[model samples]
Target: MNLILFTVVATIGYATAQSEQYTDRYDSLRIDDVLANKRLTAAYIKCMLEKGKCTAEGRELKSHITEALQNGCSKCTQKQLAGVKKVIKHLINKENAYWVELTDMYDPKKEYRHKYERELKSL
Candidate 1:
């Protein structure tokens, strides 16, 4: 019984340590890399920018992109930038599921539909 209990406790401790390492890895990642990835970026933009008001973090992301565009970044590779651009295009484009999801969430607001359309175009 003691051995079984010890084994269970050790397993839990190992799992917690592994999860903490992943959390730390994620926390230290830069915003660009966070938003550049397909799954994270789309989910974040959908929830923060489309469904709800842009959070401070979201605004910071916009600022980051604008700054990068205005004065380029030596650290950012063209491939990384291109990937982000591609994902942004997917988000704002009329053909994607993201557009449909945002529109459905913004239902019953006539102006919101136009606003969503215009926002995508502006971006």
Candidate 2:
């Protein structure tokens, strides 16, 4: 799983801790809905890859990817972290192409991704 990609999804949540964490504006996002809808998922993937226009949520998620990847999503709330785990699992198990694309974009070194995957596997 790409840690940055996971973190990006994690950024989509409801509001809270804005002073020290990402807004939870997207906290209520139904990850299952997005995962079930290929088109929607592709849109997000495209947005992340700069291959298409970004929705507000997409933009918000993209904005924090670098920092989240570097800092282990320390700013994510519990709900967002849950979303991150779900998205990471989806991308790694279901949307591998996008995962690879995202990994290239945000973690070309694979340093963060490997670390995140190890963490996920341990869980």
Candidate 3:
């Protein structure tokens, strides 16, 4: 009886530790996604501010990034998804700075709307 109880407790402890590790990894991945998406969105906004019109390219870029983010978070915990959404909303509200950086990165000559698509697909 004592050995059985000890084994069970050890198993539970191992499982709990593994769960915590996975949770931490998921959190780190989510944070990376948030930062990357923000950078991409900021670049798009910058492009629009400079051009006086939101370039179709910029719109497509934003849409693609949003799609990537949504797909990536499909299996994430609700808390993780909520955190990402908050970051997105904050970035969207930074109209001027985001636009400035976006404009600098916008290339009217490139067709890269699918830039992050492959990364999302692999996930």
Q: TM-score per candidate, in order?
A: 0.31, 0.81, 0.28
Tens-place lDDT digits, model 1, residues 1-123: 999999999999988765532112123336566546776666566554345455455554444443343343222445545544554455666336665554454343443455535644666
Where is the poorest 10-residue window by lDDT in model 1?
20-29
Q: Which residue window of length 10 is worst by lDDT in model 3?
A: 112-121
lDDT of each: 0.51, 0.86, 0.47
Winner on lDDT (2 vs 3)? 2
Alpha carbon deviation, residue 74, candidate 3 (Å): 0.3
* Model 3 steric clash pairs: 43-102, 45-99, 46-99, 46-100, 46-103, 47-102, 47-103
The per-residue C-alpha lDDT of model 3 at residue 49 equals 49
Better of 1 and 2 by TM-score: 2
Clashes of 2: 9
Shift in Å, residue 12, candidate 2 = 26
Residue pairs in candidate 1 whose N, alpha carbon or C atoms collide under 3 angstroms: none
Candidate 1 error regions (>4 Å)? 1-32, 45-90, 119-123
In model 1, the Cα lDDT at residue 68 comes to 45
lDDT for each residue of candidate 2 in 2-24, tens digit (9 for 90 to 100): 99887766775422346678888
